[model samples]
Target: MTIHTTSSCTAFEGVRRIASGALRDVAAAVKRAHDRAGGEPILVFDDATSSPIEFDLRGGVDDVLARLADAAANGAGAAGQDDEPAAARSRGRPKLGVIAREVTLLPRHWEWLNAQPGGASVALRKLVDAARLARADNERVRLAQEAVYRFMTAMGGNLPDYEEATRALYANDRARFEQMIAGWPGDIREHAAKLAAAAFCEVT
Candidate 1:
């Protein structure tokens, strides 16, 4: 999408009033002319500093379109326009190689996780991946929580009641909840801890 910007001046009035959806190149050129003459483009929205669309005014329609095509392909902006800063560059979906924030599990939590079929490291990764997938699907954190309940129902799991565990955690009595969970089956205990950690943030 070629976003063209132009000054709100009388000389470039024709550029500003171009046919809807057409003449973006002319608009861009006019804006460039205005900029060269030392005026800033007027943003249409009260909340926006710049137009949602940007335009490049370096040449004729074909030339501008060619440039726009190239930019669209390569994700570049206008010729003299500043490249997005490092902070603003990473927009859209999260990157695969980026480091995610770390959440520390208590010793008992680790012990519980270790008792799972895949052990602590694998289990934690699985939990994180599951949470990410749920978030992507727009699943409510509470709704995504059915996984914890399911895990608890498995054989040799420690948790006797998913609702009670969630209630204690939601109430902020972490110590009491952890104590209640310590005696459950190992897998249930591990799963509850994961749920608690995930739900804790949503609740607060």
Candidate 2:
């Protein structure tokens, strides 16, 4: 199994966003900025999730690149073929970390579930998977909105029309949000727009 990790990150020096891209790329940019002015505080945030990214900053850009490559290789090698006995694996669920918990349901509901082709567990899993698929788009939009809100709260709280911009953001009013943030500093406005891009696109 191949494990994929997020690639997007943004580096900010004070309120100015210096770079935005893959983790390694942003790390490189941060190094350059740090070299130009020693001791200036720099922060890197995951662009998609609006969370801080921490990495070893003791070395140079080349070191950071090597570490990133090593991480990628390790992730790929982490999940190899399982060597457990087939019969033992088949005896119960495939060690998917399933937990047994008591659930209370009406007699009619239990009856309906028990009558399903694969019984209750399989039927419930299928139903859940189907529901997740159906709601995938909405879930994506909601998460994007939440990420944007988090970034805005951390970085743009003091900007003009902050409250109105937040209201428009939650209201899914793209035009209004854009108008409200029009007077913001270029860097802040651009970063906020980038964070909210997906959420705003879902407004239609």
Candidate 3:
């Protein structure tokens, strides 16, 4: 998936952190690091998603930054969208970026939605917005868990107690999770906690 984020990103040369900051700046740093032979492979991850960002750093710094800008401008919209055919979904409001994808529902569900004042589409939108607001805290925790897990798979896969640490992470036992990774490299351990800040929140 083509992803874009304005937030910060972090890069690691094997287990050693080499850079962390704005995406473009980090890319430049990675290029410089790659030039210094005898260094470990570099992986740059988006702070928002923990996914390794792919950008061509082949040419000069300016060239890399230019390509990054081009990417953002043409960012393949958002990821994880339904793969419905273009003809199936309607362009309700092209200017507002409103895409109308197919929604499957039972007969009774459709009846209830159509009965609303503004009809099915409006009713569905309102219901979605309300549900998102109500589940904000739960959503935050879920995203954090995903972020932490993604990073762990990439960076801590071979670490001692990796399996046990994963179990504690998903179990929401913050204490146990910390203990599982206590012997990990300082940078890796600290980063895991940083990524999980929200995952361990006391959700209600």
Candidate 4:
């Protein structure tokens, strides 16, 4: 299976967000801020993870831009390929990192699995895979909500209606969340909305 990922970054100057976009764009924004604002602590964060990313700002804007360009090029090339090698399947067992683990189940459950096509192990694998596929959307929404909450806690924790905003976030109340943060700084509000965008259902 191939796993695809999207990368986003945000740069902040004190309490205010300065920029948010692709890695290269955010890096450029941070570099520009560092140059124009002197040593005033400019923090860059991974929008998905809400963690601070450190860059060698001492190397100047051109060097920073060059590094970002190289990284983006490398990432683009790598993203097209699967991380795993394709291998032929064996008769009874496959070489796809199958691990042996003891799963204690009731006798009836064991009997049901044993009666399925390809017996217990294959049946279990199929069931697990089906469940994973079914839950993928919910998992994505949960992860997106968590990411947005983390970013908000770091950026808007000191802002007005912080607790109410948090409640609205977890409650999946996009409208209320937006209303709570309506008075926040433009950049911060926009970034928060972007982060939480995936977590909410359309109001229709």
Candidate 5:
């Protein structure tokens, strides 16, 4: 049977043809997709039904399963790997695997880190990471607040003091703090939460 595939940002659409008798003999093709990709593989039974017929990709399915299998794997998009940190899932809680070395920073450099919110008790790595994370987070907060403002504007309301309101939420206003997701997409909430956790070293 001849097989053809076309791909989109998150989907792979394809078709295969086989002898009517061979329709019951698709064990090898499923094995191929499973070996190449580590996830559940799908098969389409009929062109009219968009949903895939579930098959165990761990082994193989029969030839009858071949033509019927329309696989749709959600391909990871253009977000580069570096766009996020690796998963830190482990038992208990994720630990920061930090290796420390003593360095003689100039008095000025030492003073700078010592003046941070955590003060000198904070590790140098933590201070630097916190600074970087704070910068990125501030940008995200701004974008989120802007989204909220845009939403409000759509309702014929005006947002006053965008920066002041954002700062208030980030600091003293817990109610607004919990509700300031401006223009952020839904998928990024988990990522943003994770980043916030890692930055603050807080357990959610």
Candidate 6:
């Protein structure tokens, strides 16, 4: 059974956005754009991580999409696209999708962990989940910034204030970031800001 993996994708022809939607639709749009009279430099990106999608559009649109489906079925998808997790049998709750892995702890730490209500594994999982909850806001900011940086490096590298805009992005200076990107290509600026919007929501 082919497990369908869905990912949000966007394509830009030069500095203008040509399409934004599911991977299949974006791939079709990209192929059509690339086949135009004057072929433009079209790049499809995974919105989650701002990583480029390299499609082999050698044959017709159906052929291109077929290759993508085949890759997804084999768990060999382009980086940055979210994929359904593959099932793996291991020494723990495989039904719960848990895979056992070796974890090392100091003797004192191990002793403390082993004494917890449900032993080390359950205790460790609880600790990890709690930590994630605590760091959720900061984690979102970090991920958003990373995605913005990737898009900037790919599309805005040669824009006038690229370096300053990037610095402002990381520094959480919204005003400065806006000013720095003021002179950039319109679509690039808008898309970069869109990717970074969530990061700044918790800035204050």
For residues 18-48, write the lDDT of model 1, one tens digit per residue. 2222334444555555446545443221011
- Inter-residue clash pairs, candidate 6: none
Ranking by lDDT: 3, 6, 2, 4, 1, 5
- As a TM-score, model 4 comes out at 0.63
lDDT of 6 by residue, 1-204 (tens): 233354887899999999999988988888888888887699877888887787888789999899878878677545556555556434555476788899988999999999999999999999999888768878888999999999999999998999999999898888899999988888888999899896665532
Model 2 quality (TM-score): 0.66
Task: List TM-score per model, in order.
Answer: 0.25, 0.66, 0.69, 0.63, 0.25, 0.69
Candidate 3 deviant stretches above 4 angstroms: 1-3, 76-134
- In candidate 4 the C-alpha lDDT for residue 151 amounts to 82
Alpha carbon deviation, residue 58, candidate 1 (Å): 68
Which candidate model has the greater TM-score, 1 or 2? 2
Superposed Cα deviation of residue 161, candidate 5 (Å): 14
For residues 184-204, write the lDDT of model 5, one tens digit per residue. Answer: 343232222222332232111
lDDT of 3: 0.85
Evaluate model 1: give its TM-score: 0.25
10 residues in a row with least lDDT, candidate 2: 1-10
- Number of the candidate with higher TM-score, 1 or 4: 4
Winner on lDDT (1 vs 6): 6
Measured on C-alpha atoms, candidate 5 has an lDDT of: 0.39
Q: Across residues 65-95, which tens digit of lDDT does each residue of candidate 2 receive? A: 7777777788767665567877765564557
lDDT string, candidate 4, 1-204, tens digits: 111133777789976778877876777788888888355678777877676677666687789777666665677788678655566434576567879999999999999999999999999999999888768877888888888888888888899998898898888898999999999888888888888888896321
lDDT of each: 0.49, 0.80, 0.85, 0.79, 0.39, 0.84
Q: Tally clashes: model 1.
A: 8
> Candidate 6, 89: how far from true, in Å?
10
Clashes of each: 8, 0, 0, 0, 16, 0
Model 1 regions more than 4 Å off: 1-140, 155-163, 169-173, 202-204
